[model samples]
Target: MPAFTDIMSDAFDYFRAYALRALCKARAMPRGRIKHLQLVVGRIYNLLKKEAAYAPNTQQLQDFRAAQQLEAALDRRRDDGSAPERGFAAARPGAEREAR
Candidate 1:
């Protein structure tokens, strides 16, 4: 079986992707605001940190770093517009077009 750390990491990764999708496609309500996205990212970041504290190897550490960087960029998008492209780039993965 996969290590517990691996499992948690995968779960967080999926949730991060889902949150980004919601941010990108959110309409006039709950998901459209940067504040909402920021909140989600904050929670995810905390969870990621807790998992990384017990990360079994370097690979997991690297993955956590990448996720943290993305989370920071998302936070910046909530603050300033300089990272919009990166934020949107991260906000959507695996597609050239965003969902409507």
Candidate 2:
């Protein structure tokens, strides 16, 4: 059988949801641990995108309301489901060196 390229199952949705929950709660974790959890959440995001399992309005990175208070503790708090702005300009190619 061909490997499943796309699927929208309750299990996958639950995993994605809980993973975001975990990420929201990971603010209190150690730096390394938080990074690891973020990595896992990122992978889930990529896989879900590959599956095209997301609906029109649902956010992939946070709970429905996205009112998690732990965000207040972050120096770079992000409320949207978009990628966490971990570092400015780091994602852009040669951005750091270009500034010099």
Candidate 3:
């Protein structure tokens, strides 16, 4: 099973992408305004991380540091073509038929 944090991260990322798509396609928002909204949302998300970062025991501290390092490494690897590109990707045309 995935960790709760992993699930929540996926959920938030999906929602962010959905919102951006809606803003671009339906609302025709400007890119500058979209970027500003992303920044603000990111700042608010960081507050949640901050609130959970205090009072960690030695083991928890180690795990937290390791997770941070792993995330950074994965992000750096993102440009190496190891990660699949997801932008604008969508389900196949026949997916609905398959589901039915």
Best by TM-score: 1
lDDT of 2: 0.48
| Candidate 3 structure lDDT | 0.44
Please list the residue runs of candidate 1 whose C-alpha ends up more than 4 Å from where it truly belongs after superposition. Answer: 1-29, 33-55, 81-100
Off by over 4 Å in 2: 1-8, 45-100
Order of models, best lDDT first? 1, 2, 3
Error of 3 at 58 (Å): 0.4
Model 2 lDDT at residue 43: 53
Cα error, residue 28 of model 3, in Å, equals: 18
Q: Write the per-residue lDDT of candidate 1 for residues 1-100, one digit (tens) a residue.
A: 8886665655456545645554453333344445565555556555544565445456645665665676677656656865343344435574655554
lDDT of 3 by residue, 1-100 (tens): 9886664444345444534443343233334433344444444334334433443234534544454454345435543746454444338877667666
Ranking by TM-score: 1, 3, 2
